[model samples]
Every structure is written in structure tokens, then in C-alpha cells.
Target chain A: PDPALDDAIRAVIDGKTKPLGALGRIETLAARLARLQGTTAPRMERCTLTIFAADHGIAAEGVSAFPQEVTVQMALNFLAGGAAANVFARTLGVQLRVVDAGMAEPVDHPALVQRRMGPGTANSAVAPAMSPETLAEALASGRALGADGDADACAFGEMGIANTSAATLVIHKLSGLPIATLTGRGTGLDDAGLSAKRAVLERAAARTGALPPEAALAEYGGFEIAMMAGAMIGAAQARRAVIVDGFIATAAAMAAQAIAPGCEAAFVFAHRSDEAGHAAALEHLGARPLLDLNLRLGEGTGALLAWPLLRAAAAMMTDMASFESAGVAGKT
Target chain B: PDPALDDAIRAVIDGKTKPLGALGRIETLAARLARLQGTTAPRMERCTLTIFAADHGIAAEGVSAFPQEVTVQMALNFLAGGAAANVFARTLGVQLRVVDAGMAEPVDHPALVQRRMGPGTANSAVAPAMSPETLAEALASGRALGADGDADACAFGEMGIANTSAATLVIHKLSGLPIATLTGRGTGLDDAGLSAKRAVLERAAARTGALPPEAALAEYGGFEIAMMAGAMIGAAQARRAVIVDGFIATAAAMAAQAIAPGCEAAFVFAHRSDEAGHAAALEHLGARPLLDLNLRLGEGTGALLAWPLLRAAAAMMTDMASFESAGVAGKT
Candidate 1:
């Protein structure tokens, strides 16, 4: 952390018209923005939301309510500017970038980033999900996306059917939380389907017991998850604010923290998910997300929702006149 | 709320690519916009924030950390567009109107909405705050502001130094909550200052116990508090989405609910205040604020912070292609 910048910005925020720390988390956000940008006048103007798309082989186990085809389709929707993330990003002027980390089928669109690691990862219930080479490729692709010079901040989202099951297993291994506690209604499963999902995920967790970071990525990580973890690392390294979305995104952030030491500094957890596992996941990371609107959609929608708060925090630091400048009296 | 429009708008929100209620509070906000506009295709293009500034007689009791003169000075700051509200409202394209509801000294500015009920209210610790006629005039003015035909929605905030004391007294009279629970650091009070303020408020509350809405307005309400409550009622009557700010604004909201029935339908609580009393105050209103940023600054900054969310919610309902149109598969 930039201690000098933190001290300078703290004085700036304190000298504002209102009470000390009266802006609450916004003051905290302002300090973080200053630390990340290495200046008190932090600008969050060229923000970007990058969605990594892939298929999870766990879908073959009937863990998701939607077909794996939905992954590519959602990516197409993002490219077509029809998803919730598109609406939110358009509102905040956040540039949208779609990366084809590893979809089952090849996608060729004007905006579709062609960085596929493979068709998809293998089912973790049966064997390790990805080869070491594929894991490295996905991580590199994410790193490339995260370091785009024009981007001052990045909102990382993913589109992969049955990826939540993969995330649950990965979190269970990484955080040592019980698989049952980490499981949730991915894509809105019913009682019977949830039971089936739990049974499958429990088996997958047992199969990939307590692997190291590389082996864990090779074991339970979907291509999009691995790529997102890489993107988080890349964003942090580039000193860009990393705005993570919902449950899957938080899991990816955890993975990124483990992969690249000291990368959590650039991160801002956007919102808490209604998914049962999300609160524990955020708590495990010792993160306090900006909003908790009960969002569970994956396309960086939560991060996009929180974009305004961050922008306002920076704006407050730069634009708002201090009590001395505005000639407003301090507390007697 | 228009039930027919509500049903149609729910269909529109549900038909989006995201899951049912996956957008959570945003879906609720979208439905509210549709209801307010009486159409599924609601527009939130022209938003307005009306900040009412007034002096409170409670300040004379030395209950506030700041002098009463700060109210008029902050009003001038708002007129000059140098305050936090100006910064946030400028960012969000929201029109700002600063109204001098009542202050001890006269303020002159081209942009100031000159509508003072009196120089200031009488000291509520010893006598009534405002005359019955003054209370009526303040409410009517607030109603007039709320019914501005050009504004699609209204964000009500206030800039009254020492108004938190007035608000605490009002809430104590209305909801009968313990005085200690509803009192908080107004503009940053030290330990001794807080203790002194509490003692003064307790005495003031003892002098005026269990007053009705009109009596409470006369006994405990500051001109700004009365006017804000009136604005809430006025906005709700005009079917405008009333975006309320932090602690004082929430207290005004409770006052509005007491005065006018069914106004809660058009109300949107902006964010939770870090004030100790604000959580219980919000709970009494049965309101779930859109954000929990812990903002205590009361220049409509919290409402402006939430403006993007409300606008995006409306935009999502209007601009985004439905799942049927996007050809995205729904949950099985």
C-alpha cells in the first residue's frame, strides 16, 4: 500500500465539508482508489468489463439447469450488447470486452476475443479438469486482457454453464469450507436437481482433495475461472482497480489472491450474492463488498452496479471543494 | 403503483436474459419506475434534487457541534455548486434546486429558492418550533416543489446545521423510540459534546411527549424537516419516485408517512446512514435502502449516488432485449 498517498488522501477527505469519515465506506473507497492510483486525485474514467466464457464439463453431470450451449450464447449476448452487464456498462461508460477462454465450440465474431485454451476442461468428478499447458494458456490470456493500457479499472465476469459447481469445489478446496456449505442453486435448480448437484459436487471435492494452486487450477478450475484469476492478477499488477462481480467472480478473486501474492490490494468486491455460498466466500476473503443487492447474475452485473459508487468516491476526492475552500464552518 | 403496469413490467423484467429476481432490488426499482410513470416503458431522464436548508431552534440549546450560521453558509455553497451534492448531481445529470425553507439569516443568490417560513423555528426545548400557519406554508411549498412537471423523479435532501437534534426529537415523539437510540453525531461531535447533546435532547423530549403529526411538527420539527416531509408527501402524490437521503431525510420520511398515508409506495430510500439512530429509524419505516454506503452527509449526495441505479433500472426495463428476443435459454 502507498502509505504516503493514504496519508495525503485521508487529510483531503477529512478536510471536506462534512464530518470526518462521514462518507463511511465511500471514504474508505476514496483511500483505496488513491492507494491504487498512487495519487489523491485518482481518476476511474476508462473502466472496462471483461467477460471470460467457457464450458464446464461438470454440466454433463446435470449440475446446471441450463445447457452448456448457454455459455457461448451469453458471450454472444454480451458481444451483441444485450446482457445486463451491457446495460450497466453503457450507463457507466465502461468498455465491454469478451474473451473466449475455452468454449466447447469455436466462436467467430467481430468482438469475440479468440484466446481459447481448449474445447473445455475435463469433468473433475472423473479426472483433473485442465492440462497444465491449458491452465497456463488461460492465465496468460487473462493477464493480457487485464493489462490493456487504456483501462484504468476492470470488472471481471464469466459465462460458463455449471461453472458454479466448479467454483464450489474450488472454494471448498481453497478455503477448506465444507462442499455442502459452498453448494448453491446454480441457474435455479429445484430440490431434486439441487440434491443431484450436491451429490456430484461432494464427489468432485473428494476426488480433488486439497491440491496446490497449480494442481487446483488443473483439477477443478474451468477455463474461464482460470482466465479470470489471471485477469485479476494482471489487473492488480497493472495497478488497475479490480471490481469483482458475484459468487463465481469472488471465487476467481480468491484464486487470484492465492496465485499472485499481494494482488488483493487492487480488488473491490462489488456485491454479495444471494447464492448460499457467497457470504462465506466473501467472509473468508475478509472482504466487504460495496453493495448487497442480492445479485447472482454472473456477467459482471454486480460490479457494474457498483461502478457509480467508486466513480463518486473518486469524484468526491477530486471535485468536491473542502470546507476551507467552500467557506463552510467546521464543527464547533 | 399501477398493478396492470406492474404486471406488464414484471413480465418485461422477467423476460430479460437474467434469472427471475436475480437482479434483486434492481428489479424492484424497475417495477417502481414503471409504476410511477404508469407504463412499462418508463423514462428517468430528467431527475431533480431539491435540498431544503433551515435553522433549528435546538441549535440555540448548544446541542449541535456547529453553529446555526453554518446552515445559511452551506445553502450558499449549494447555490455556488461547490458542495458534495453539486459534485454528485453534476456527475449524474440531475438538476439541483436549493431551497431556503427557513434560516436565521437571509441568504441571497440567483439560484436560491427563496421560501423561508420564518427566520428560524422557536426553541422546541421550551416552546413550539413553528406556528401552525408556518407549518402549513412549509408543507405547501414542499408540495409545490414535488409537483414540478418537468422532473421525472425527485431526490429530497437537506442542509440544516443541527437538524439532527430536531430529527431525533421528532422521531422520539412519533415512534416513541428511546431518545438515546435515535440521537447521533450530527456533524462530528466529540465524546463530551455527544454526551451534552444527549442530555439536552432528553430534556427537550420530556418537555414535548407523544405529540401527534401536526403537534409533532409544531413542537419538534425544524422548518427543513417539515418541508422535507411535505416534499415526500407532495412527490408521492404526484406519482414521482421520491429518492430520500441519509438520517435526517429518513426521519423526514417517517414524518411524511405519518402525515400522509400510502406515500411509501412512491418512496425509494437511498442509503443507510452511519448514525447510531438511523438503523432503527429505517427499520421503523420498513424501508430497505438501495445502498448501505454508511453515508452521513445530507446534501442529497446519497440520493445522487443511487441515481445511477434507479436510472439503470429504468433503462434495463426499456432498452435491453428480452430473453425471447435475445434467444437465450431460460432455466429448465
Candidate 2:
């Protein structure tokens, strides 16, 4: 932890707000921000949510029961405010922008921000799917959105069929873990399907000479994941708290961490999911998940569920009657 | 479920404000209320949180590491707004009222409602300590608070040291399950402590004759538990949603359900807890917990943590754009 940032955070906690450390994680995050900015009472206005929609090359391999077209449908659904994610964003009173970073179809929804790198990447099993230029474009798009949102806090969520397989490959390559350990039934695949998915990921991992972390992501990463990694870095550079959701978001966080070490300071693990690799990914990042519901429904649902706790934490920081304010004797 | 209440609930779900069946649980709760009250578009304006603070007789048996005095201290902590529950209630803008139905000390906080049934009960190992009169008073106090809040929704939470042992006994007797299966280390008790706790509860159950259902509660139940049960029944009578918390609260729900079969329609399990017996209690009530965070931290932390999801469900019911509204085609 940066000492200056730590001090700033401590000051916010110690401020004449609520009780000291009353707002558990929210206070912790706010204080950390105060320290990062070397100020007390750091403001957290202008929250932004970046919804990255992509199609997984691995989807063609039958990992998910839903066809790859469902990804495009859901992405369009997101833009149309019909999906669970859209409802959550609206309820949270947060600004939501949908990005079609790698959709196979030309997303016609007016609400969607068309930043397509291509009509989706080539199948990961065959070769390095996304090219260097596409990866760079995805990253640039993420940064551009962060700047555009002028977000004081930002979160990244993705919508794509079989993206978990793409995330599994990303995690295996980045964490240097074997495919079997990291891979599981992505979106309800059975034993045989899981085994086939693992084999495909292993083949993809080996094709790129265990492509050095950053290069590996550019090689095997989904357009959404790489772009989200960029968004994480951009949010951090802008001094915003980056709330991360389950497996795929963690993979993006890892990529972001690799690219910009300082970004870790801005990240908070929202929840531990039922997904097999989520725990390992959380452990690797030394992040404590806020909730541990067996939720595999991604689209930042887990994060949205955890939002009230965050607000409570902030409220505790701002409203709790501290030892001094209440004139209560502290632990002797 | 009442046929009238069921029809009322369906009407709310089919209201012109949103698409059919899009609001999910919120719509379900509203529709259930419609049937219960014979109206549609039921509103949940006034929300109440009845926090029951007590001292467990089991605490005298050295079941918990924290001294029994800590219960009073924490109860005071709650009234002083220094506890996690206080911050949560404040953030949700919900009214919180603490009831000292079984506290050993004369609760000093002016904010607390003095509904003390007794100073405290005797050790359950000796007998089914609380007399019928005291249990009745506690139950009435809870019911009165529920009515007074005029709440559209009500939630039950507790603040008592070593109360988990009391809850365990309630679970075992209510579910007719083995004490060992239901017992857990309450508030971080170790293996030895747990074994001793289990033995005490088993003995208490045998001594009490394990009274039948609701009647059993008067024999072995704490003031807080009994009061919460009354509150649940009162909320049901008011046609409000009763958001049930973990073990102890679920025990109250069970008692309420036994006394008033119609109350089951009003209850919503907030989360599947890490507590050993919580799942069994929820299953017995045919309730589905909204979140499953493996969290056993009592004091309504889990339920309060889940409030956002509940609000989101309501928001989705009220805010989501239908296919027609968004000009998007619905999936066939």
C-alpha cells in the first residue's frame, strides 16, 4: 500500500463522519481513495458501468448449450434494456454504456456503442484468434470510454456466450495454471463437454509458446476481456475505484494488473462466485470477495447485489456516531 | 396461498406498468399481497426492522468466548449506532427499533423500545426456563411493534451473545433433526466448544419434552425469538412481506408459520447462510434464499446485505423496458 494513500484513507476513516471503521469495506475503499489522492473525504460521484459484449471463438466448439448467436442477442438485449444487467444498472442509478467489441453481427441497437474490432475474432483453437491491431484497438476503446464516462468509480461486466472458456484460457495462460484445474463446465456443460473444452484450451495455450502474459492475452483473449483490461487501467489512472465482478472480470483485472501495477489499488473484488476458477483467481489477486453466493450469472449481477453493502459502508463512514461523537468509551 | 391473494398478486404482475412476469420476485411478493388484501399494485412504503436483543442462558455455560456482558455492550452499541446493523438500516432508509425482550441489563439507550419480558431466562439445561406468561409477553411485544410500524415490510434480526445455542435448540426441536447436525460453533467457537454446545442443546431438548411446533417455542424459546415470531405474524396480518434472516430469525418464522399458516405467504428467505441448520430451516419453510454467501455473521448482516437485490427486483418490476417500449423483438 502506498503510505500517502494509506494515510489519506485513514484520515477519512478518522474524520468527523460516522463511527471509525463503521462502513466496513466502503469506508476502507473511500479511505484508500482519500490517501491515494492525499486528501480527506474523497468524493465518489459519477459512477460508470462498462458492459463489454463479445463472441467467444470457443463458442463454436459447443461449450455452451446456447448458440453463439445468443451472445449477439444478449448484447442487443443489453442495449435494449431488456437483460438483468440493464435492470440492475438502472436500479443502481449508474450510467451504463454497452460496447460491441467483438460481436459477429452489426449491432443495430441505438443504445450500443459500436467499437467492434472485427466481426469477432477467429476460433482460438485454430490459431492466435485476435490480432495485435484488434487487441490494441480494444484497449484504446476501453480507455476512451473511461475518459468519456468521466467516472469517479467504474465497474466492468461482460456478456458473451462461452466467454468463460475464453476467460479460462486467459486465466490459465496468465496464472501459469494448468487447463484442467482452471477450467470447469462453462454455463452447464457436462463431463464430456468439460473435458473437450479443457483440451481445446490446452491446445490454444500451447500454440502461443505460453505467450508471455500481455502477448498471450492479445493472442487468445476475447475482445471484451482485453478491452475490459484497458478500462480497468484507465479507471485506475483517473483515480477511480474499479469494482470487479466474477471470473472473467478477474481475468481482466489480472491483465490490467500486469499492464499497470498501480491499478490494483483501485480494484475491489465484489463477490466470490460458484464458478470453479473464481476462488483461485481471487486468491491470486489477494482480493477478499465481498459476497460468496453460488452465483454464476455474470453481467455484474453479483456486483450489483453487493452494491448496497458498499453504500452501507459509505454510510457508516459518513453517518455512524463515532466513539468521540457518541462520547462512548473506547476499548480499554 | 389464499386464492384471492394469489389472484391479486397475479394482477400486480400483469399491471400495465411493466411486461408480464418481468418483475420476478418483487412482482411475486406484490401479487401475493394483492391476493391477501384483494388489491393490485400494492405499495411497500413503510419498512420496519425489529431488532431483538437478548442474553442467552447458554452464555452462562461458557459456550461463547465473549462474556455475557458483551451482549449488553453490543446492544448498547447498536442503540449508539456503532454496530454494523445500525449503519445498514440507516443506508436503506429503514426505521430500526430495538426490543429488549431478554436482555440481562436494563438497556440504557433511549432509542431502544423497552419491551423487556424478563431480566433473562434460566439455563435451559435446568428446564424450559421461560414461563408461558413471559413468552406470551415477548410474543405480544413483537406483534405490537409490527403493528405500530404500520410497515409494508418487516425483517427480524437479533443481538444476543451465545444465542446460536438457543437457536440450535429451536432448530433441533422444530425440525426433529439431530442436535449434532444442526449445531455449529456460534460466533467462532472451536471444536471442543461446539461439542459441549451440542451436548447442552440435546439435553435441553430432552428435558423440555420438545413441545409440538408453536407450543414447543414457549418451553425453550428466548424472549427475542418469541417476539420475532409474533412480529412475523403481525406483519402477515398487515399483508406485508416478512423478510426472514438466518437461523434464529428462521426459527421465529417457523414458529410464526405454525401459528398462522397464511404467514408463509408473507415470508421471503433473504439468504442461504453458512450456518449448519439454516438450509434445513429454509427448506422446511419452502423458502428460497436470495443470496448464498456462506455468511454466518448474524445481526441481520446477511439480510441487510441482500436488501439491494430486493430493491433491484422491485426496480426491474417497475423500470425495465418491455420489448414494445424498447422496440426490440422478444424471444420466441
Candidate 3:
């Protein structure tokens, strides 16, 4: 980000006809967008939400509340325009894309982007989630997908049973936070189910120690998570704003930030999730999301919901009249 | 609002293809719209943002940051589509209406609605802010304006100089909160300005121990505030959802609720403002706003920014598929 450009944007925002700083966080958001685009006025006219769907082998350990088949079902739901993501995307006029990264049984829809790395990742509780070759393929495929879109911003979502467990272990290894603190109810888990999931994640964490980011992904990350990380990096390379969804998408962003340290400059976190460990994860990244509606459903729904605020901020920069232009008196 | 219909809406929301309560506040918002409209599916397709502009008598006490003439200037700004409210209303497809409730100087724009009771109100710190006849005229005029729109939802905004002072005293009288606690820097006041404002409001509060709602409005309310209160009640009576804006608008809502006890059922608080005592005012009404962007720019901008979320919620009710229809398995 250019400090000079940021100062210029701030000056313009301050000259608006409202009280100094009365626009509040919206002023801050406008400045951030301007600095990212290196322009006085930025536009968020077109946005695309990419939902990466995969199955987690960790589901074999009974980690998620729903069975693994739900992943493919949701992928099909997205293609059929029947999911929450589809509804929100339609409401906001956002383009929606669903990708099948690696499901146990692939959905055969013409609209589904097939970028499968394997049937699914191996269960991390007993072994590494994926081979290094599979990890490389996933990252490369996601980079291509992210680079192909012409939208000004790209939002990422994930659909995988037991993926929250995968995200928790990945984050625990990356940040060294406690396993119990980072684990939570995935899709409405009962107390016993939550405890059991935490115990299983502990077993997965015990299998490795102090691994690099790549090794961490190969060991603990699901196919969709690794791909989303690479997609985020690629989107940043293309200079598009990376709008990260809820907790699982945050895990992908954490991985992306680790792999490409400067790519997080493109990230605009959408909301703080009700999921356990989300707040800690956000704190670790020094990120504050735009909305906090206790949203935990994650098919890029939260990211799509925040799209209007970005538009409003950009419009404020481009459309609002300055005090002098509006012939209004300034503060005494 | 029907209790049985609310239960039916809740059931419909739960049966959507996501987990129970996964959509967070959105689920609650959908149910609220449904209950308010007395339907399982409510639509927010058309919305109107009515900005009531007036000059507050409190400005004579030096309680505001700007001169009272800014009110007429902003009303012209709104008519010219150069203000933040105009931009947001355009972006959200909401109709924008500018009402000259009782500005000291009337704007000559062809689109301006002239509902002037007088050439402004009297100074409230020394005497009554408005005559009883003026208050009654303002309410009736606002009621007619609110009931005349063909919109599913109505949002209220105020653009009156020193109106925050008027709202502070009005809320203090109605809510019985301490005047000092309810006073704040309206539009970027320095510490000394804030102290001066608080002292003036305390003096106004001491003018009457405990007045009836109408008497208090005549003694301390602005024409814009009285009009907005009447507008909210009229919109509720017309079965249109009422979206209340920041500090001044909340004070109007408080008065509206006091005037008609059940009118608040149609109210949807838009955002928590950065202004002081806004949280206390919201608490007094038992309200939790949909957004919290620290926005203090009134002109209905905060309410307009929140319009997309309401649309998404309504779309979720009308569009999203149930698990049975999508053939997705339930939680195991």
C-alpha cells in the first residue's frame, strides 16, 4: 500500500460534507480500497464468489455432524442455485462459481469446475492428509482458477464435512494455539461430539511437530483448503481484492498469508464467525472483519453479504460532494 | 405480529439446506420481516428513504457544531443527488424523498415537499421549542407523507442543525435518563463544546419535571423529530417495516413508541452510531441494530447501507431450498 496515496484518499474523505470522521469506519474502508487500488476512487462493481467443495477423510473419525456425502450434495446445491450462497449471490448480483476440488464422489454438473487432486485427502488422524505431489497439483490448479476470473474482487468459500476439524488442526500447527480452544461444533455438534472431535484433532496434531507451511498443508489441510489458499495468492497477484468468508476460509487465508507473506494486503475479511477459535484466529492475523452477525454457514454467504458495504464506501469516494463543492460551512 | 406465524416462519427457516441457526442474525431478521408482515414469506423489494430537514431552535443556544442554515443547504444537496444519502439510496434502489419539515429557510427545489409548520422552532433552553399547533401539524403532515409511499419499507433520516440537542432533551424527558449521560458531541465537537452542550440540555431538562409525551415534544422536540416519530407510526400502521436511522432518528422512535406503545413492533433499528448516548437510547428501546459501522452521518446512510442485508434475508426465505427438496441428509 502507498502511504502517499492513502493520505490523499484520507484528505478527500475528510473534505466530504459530513462532520470530520463522522462517517466512521466507512471512511477507513474507503481509504483502504483506494490505497489497495492506488487510486483516489475505486470501484467494486463486479464480484465473483468461488465455492471450493471437497470431502475430508477426517470424517471417517466421526468429526462432523453431517456425513461426508453432504459435501457433494452441497456442491450440487450450489450448481442448482438452491444454496444460501446462491441466494445471496443472486440478491447481490454477484457471479457464483462452484469448484469440485476433491470429493469422494464427484458431482457431475456441467457448471461444476472439476479440479480434483484426488478422491479425497487421507485421514490426518493417522497419516498426512495428502501426498506432496497432490498438494502441488492442488495449489497450481487453484492458482489457475483464481487467475482466470476478471472480476474486481473474489470471495472464497468451502464445503467439506469435517473441514472445520481440518482447519482447526492446520491453525493449531500454524499458530501453536491449544487444540481444545481451536475446536468447535461443526454443523451443530453435541457436547460429546465436540469433545470427540477435539480428541481426534489432538491425535492429528500429535503426528507432526514444527512443520513448514507446505508440510503443514500436506499433513493437516483438506484439498479445498490448500486450493483456496493458492487461489487467494493468485487473486492477489492479479490485483483483485480477496474477500475471505468465515472460519474455514480464514484458515485458507492464513495458509495463503504464510505462503505469500504480502498477499494478505488483498484480503478483506467478511465477518467474525460464531465458530470457536475464529476470534483468536482473527486476532492472530491482526484482522477485523467488516460484519459480525454470528454467521457460521460458509458457502461464501458472509462475503457476499458484505459486498454492498464495499460498494457504498467506493461510491462515497467517487460520488459524495466535498464541503466546498456542496457550498456548506465547515466546523468552527 | 402473529406468534403462530412466527413459529411457522422459524420452521421454514430451519428447514433450509443449512444447519439450524447457521445463518445467524439473518435468520432472525427473516423471521422478523415475516412476523411483521404476518406472512411466512415477506418481501422488501421496494424501499423509500425519507429525509426530514428542519432547523432546530436549540442552535440559538450554541449547542451545535454548524450554523442552522446548513439544514437548508443539505436539503438542497439531497435534492441535487449530491449527498451520501442520495448515493446510497440510488445504489440500493430505494426511493429518496426530501421533506422540508420546518427549516428556517425554505429550499426552492421543485422536488422539495413543503410541510413547514413555521419558519423553525423556538429556543427550547429558554422556552417551548414549538407551539402545540405546530407539533400537531408536523405529525399530521409526516403521517400523510409516510402513508403516501408505495414502498414495502420506510427509512427515516434527519438533517437539522442542533437537532441532536433537540433529540437529547426529547429522549431525556421520555426515557428519564440523565441529561448529561444522554448528551454528546453532535457533529465533531471539541471537549468544551460538548460541556457547553450538556449544560444547555440540562437547563432545558430542568424546565419540566415530568411532562406528558405531547407536552414534552412541544417543550423540547424539533419539527423534524416530531415528523419522523409520526412517520414511523404511520408506516407501521400501513404495515410497512420502519427502518430507524442513528441518534436523532432513535429519539424520534422513542417518541413514536411512547405515543403508540405497539408501534415499535414495526421498527428495525439500522445501526449503532458513534454518537454518545446512542447505545443508551437503543437500550431504552430494547433494540439491537442490524449493522454497527460507527456511522454518525444521518441522512439515512446507515439505514441504506443495511438494505442489502434485509434483501438477502427476504431472498433466503423466498428462494433457498429445503433439505427435503435438495435431497441433502439431515444432521447425523
- Name the lDDT value of residue A221 in candidate 3: 96
Off by over 4 Å in 1: B1-3
Q: Which residue pairs of candidate 1 clash?
A: none
Best by DockQ: 3
Model 3 segments more than 4 A misplaced: none
Task: Let me know the DockQ for model 1.
Answer: 0.74
RMSD per candidate (Å) reads: 1.5, 5.8, 1.1
Q: How many backbone clashes does candidate 2 have?
A: 11
Rate residue A128 of model 1 by lDDT: 88
lDDT computed for candidate 3: 0.89
- Which of the two candidates, 2 or 3, achieves a greater TM-score against the reference? 3
Candidate 2 lDDT tens digits, B1-332: 46765654454345322223323354554454445545543444456677888876767777774567766776776777766677778777667777888789886667888888777777776776587777777778777776665666677788777777777777777778778887876566668877888787777778866477656776667778888899888888877778888888888888888877777877778877776777877777678787665656567765676666555655554555444554443322
TM-score of chain A of 3: 0.98
What local lDDT score does residue B244 receive in model 1, on the 0 to 100 scale?
84
Model 3 lDDT tens row, B1-332: 46788789989999999999999999998888888888888998999999999887779889988887888888888988889999888877889989989899867878998888778889999999988888888888878888886888999898999988998999999999888888999987889999999998998889888988988888999999999999998998888889989999998999988988888888988999988989999998889998898999898888898888888999999999999999999998
Tell me the deviation in Å of residue A270 in model 1: 0.5
**Model 3 clash pairs?**
none
- For candidate 1, give the lDDT of residue B156: 85
